[model samples]
Target chain A: MHKFANPTFFMKIANGIFPWATGISILCFAVGLPLALIISPPDYQQGDTVRIMYVHVPAAWMGLMVYGVMAASSAVFLIWRHTIAHLVARASAPIGAVFTALCLVTGMLWGEPMWGTWWVWDARLTSMLILFFLYLGYIALGDSFEDQERGDKAAALLALVGSVNLPIVHFSVEWWNTLHQPAIFGLKGFSVNAAMLQPLLLMVAAFQFYYIAVLVIRLRAELLSAKIRTARFNLAAAE
Target chain B: MTRKRRRLYFVGLGLLGLFSATALMLTAVEDNIVFFFSPTELKARTVAPEQRMRVGGLVEEGSVNKSGGTVRFTVTDTVESLTIQYNGILPDLFREGQGIVAEGRMGRDGVFLANDVLAKHDETYMPPEVADALKKSGNWHPEGATAQAAEAKPATTSN
Candidate 1:
């Protein structure tokens, strides 16, 4: 793991993985969407609108999952001072942010039909909304500082602090008398029937792969950007 | 702190000011953020005095009574039911046994006078709060659900 922290070695690995990840992401979505939209039976109750779950639920899952990854990477970067770890965390933020935004938008679109309102401040929704804002804040804080290392450290710390919300976001429906739904897959097991579960799982797996692909691509970009900055700084110093 | 630090301070202050303003705005619109009401809560606490607030729950089967432009219905969380009155274009997804949230206040005579009605958009999804209430009521059923059911499915319907 430490050896992989070296930028040159990390780049080589990312180069190899990026294409496969992208391919898998494309394949998963290609397969997942239709099955989710068409193949799955129109729910006995909800009918056709059940299709949005293929997109909305996966996005929400990724949003939370990516944040978890970021927080973990931040811990690694802070503890080990591994630049690659920081790079990985940095690369994941925007992708996670996009997923979070997608979840909110699709959720609202779904909500308007189901809930009869476009938005809600219910704990789950509110926390997710806050998660989106936190992403923006992390990015802004990362760019705000003049010292790049300072920026990374600040953003990493922010990510760590933000992790505190994940559990709350997850359990807010349970802990508080909330307007959001409780966990479908808890220790007690699933409340949903298998007909719906199969497609959902496939989409979730596809989303996870897509997340990894995007993270790899973004990591490469961050590496290249860092190299360019370093080269420019060296040239200026020489002058 | 030097002059550069002072400038940074100002920048931080500006950002903080902007953030604070946004928080205030969200706080002000807080009332508008919630979508539905459980029948139990609406009937007992929020609707008894006929408070003007949104009522959300499942549209009770056999309870929808269409009267010209105005539709009267009952929303239930299985434990309790709230009667809702709405005079508006209902969403295409609105259905029986589905999750719903309606906006407006409680009216006199123990009726929910809704200005807006919302339908659940995803299959198997309940508002987190509603789901909890259901679980508390011991009405929740968890069985034979596959992987997607791991997360709450939005209670969505079609147009």
Candidate 2:
């Protein structure tokens, strides 16, 4: 576990996987975009507007999944005092926020045409909006303290606390009277037709790879900043 | 105790307090949840005028009326019904005898004045409550439940 936390070792692993992550993600988008927009038949009810599902569903999944990653990494940082874990949580915040924003925006576009409104304060949407705010709050809190160590710890704690919103966002439709429909992929079977399912799953995979590629890049940058800080300290000591 | 252990305890307590506060807030707001009501459920309770709520079920046969830009329709579970008035273009999927959900509040005159109406994203999809209510009303015939048949049913009923 300590070996995995070492910056040099972690960067080696990140560099190795970076190329594959970017390559597969680009391939996925290349295929997924066309299939989602053209090949797949429009919903019998929704027509062309249903095409938005490809981007919206994947973004929503990433918004929740990235938060989960941040939360887990944050817990590891808090428990084990691993700087890498905290760095990871910090790096993921903005990406998660972007995905959450995409989910909201696409949802609005779809809602206006199909649900007949651009927004509603319903369970699913309200929880998702809150999730977006939580990401923003975490980002801001990470830089609020003067002490860098204290700021990192506080941000890790915030990430852990904010994780409670994830389950609420997911189950809001089931637990409350919500405007959103239940998930398409259920325990029983895929609720959506195969034609739509293919592109949706591909887009989800694409986003997952996108996260991995971006995270490694950011993690490398974080490590470089840490080295620079140490070098600055050394120069001051020499002075 | 070590400083690290003390810090851990503080964080543990903070999380506990935060979670409890969230739980309490959720409980306090429970009544305002406004679950989707079938027309039957809507009938059983009195919703105050301008209180936002959702009513979902099948659009009643031969009930949708268009005049200029305004549209009025009755939504039903076959047992009870609510009149909805709207001044907007309905979703492409909106048709009589098809499952839909409308979000709005009661007008002072008792009619539901809806600003939004939602139809299922797919023909195969039916809001569970709408299906249950239709079944309860003994009017659920799966063979004729296609969107095309739904479009035809209202016209035939009008004739």
Candidate 3:
């Protein structure tokens, strides 16, 4: 774990995993898309509109999952002063934001037809919206300062603070009388039937792999920019 | 303590404090955080008739009355039930014995005059054939199934 703090070592491992991630992600999507959209049975109640769950649920899971990654990495960066960890958090913000936005949009699309309203100020929905804003805030704050260290620390602190929303988002349906349904999969057992669960699980796997593939590319870019900045600073000192 | 150790403690304590604060705040605003109230909850408290609120419950079986543009239904949580009157298009999922949430003010009369009606779905998802079988077998429950009922059907499985 300490050795992984080295950016070069980290990048080497990331690069090795990148190809596998990309290949698996592509394969999952290739199979999962057809399974989710066409082959999977339409819901007994929702009909074709139930197809939206394939994308919406996975994206929602990714949104929360990515934020958990970001927050954990931020903690690692702060505690261990690992540049790679900080970079991982930085690389994840945009991707997490995109996933959150996708979740929100797909939710609205699903909601409009099924719930009779495009938006509601329910606890689950509101907490998720706040998660999206937290991602955006992390990005904006990280780039706000002239001193990169100060910006990183500030943004990392924000990530930690914002993490309080995660549990609230997950349990909001049960904790409150929200319009959102309770979780289909939880500690008790799966409420969803096997047929729907297959496609849902496949899509979730596809999204997870896709995130890894994208994160590897973004992490490389972050590493390169950090290197260029250091090089420029060294040149200025020499001059 | 080492500098790194100190930083670790700082972060750990910060998160602990933040979580505690959040829990307290949420507890303080518990009533406001609930999106809607069940029929039993609504009945348990005194609510102003003019104050707009959202009430959610299952639509009672055989209680739906549709007349032209106006629709009337009883929303029940098995413990208590409230009459809801709405004038608008209902969602595709709206049906008798299905859960629904209506937003509006309580009228001078006993009826709740709702401006918006949203259908709420349970977490259960199965194909039409399985649902038909369950219905035929007298094992169908709208909210969720009993463990015994679920175990009886080989076709029914969950992750």
**lDDT (tens digit, per residue) of candidate 3 on A1-239:** 59999888989999999999999989988998898888888878888888899999999999999999999999998998998999999999999999999999999999999998999999999999999999999999999999999999999989989999999999999888899988878765666667787889889999999999999999989988988999999999999
Q: Candidate 1 lDDT, tens digit per residue, B43-125? A: 45533454556666778889999989999998877788888899999887687766677878767677878887766433253
Q: Regarding DockQ, does 2 or 3 come out ahead? A: 3
Q: Which stretches of candidate 3 lie over 4 Å from their true place?
A: B146-152, B156-159
lDDT tens digits, residues B17-134, model 2? 9878887887788656645788888878887776888888778889999999999999887788889998887886689876778878988887999987887443233334334444
Lowest summed lDDT window (length 10), candidate 3 chain A: A186-195
True contacts kept of each: 0.19, 0.23, 0.83
| Per-prediction tally of clashes | 33, 0, 0
- Residue A59 alpha-carbon offset, candidate 2, angstroms: 0.7
Error of 2 at B78 (Å): 6.1
The reply for model 1, stretches above 4 Å from the true place, is A177-180, A188-195, B1-39, B42-51, B77-80, B120-159
For all candidates in order, the CA lDDT equals 0.72, 0.80, 0.90
DockQ of 1: 0.14
**Measured with DockQ on alpha carbons, how good is candidate 2?**
0.20
Give a tens-digit lDDT track for model 3, residues B68-126.
99999999999999999999999999999888999999998889999999999888777
DockQ agreement of candidate 3 with the native complex: 0.67
* Second chain TM-score, each model: 0.54, 0.58, 0.92
Highest lDDT model number: 3
What is candidate 2's lDDT per residue for A1-239, written digit by digit as tens? 57998877988999999999999999999999998988877665566877888999999999999999999889878977878888899999999999999999999999888777788787888889999999999999988999999999888888998987887888777677566776665555454545667888999999999999999989988888999999999999999
TM-scores for every candidate against the unseen true structure: 0.74, 0.83, 0.97
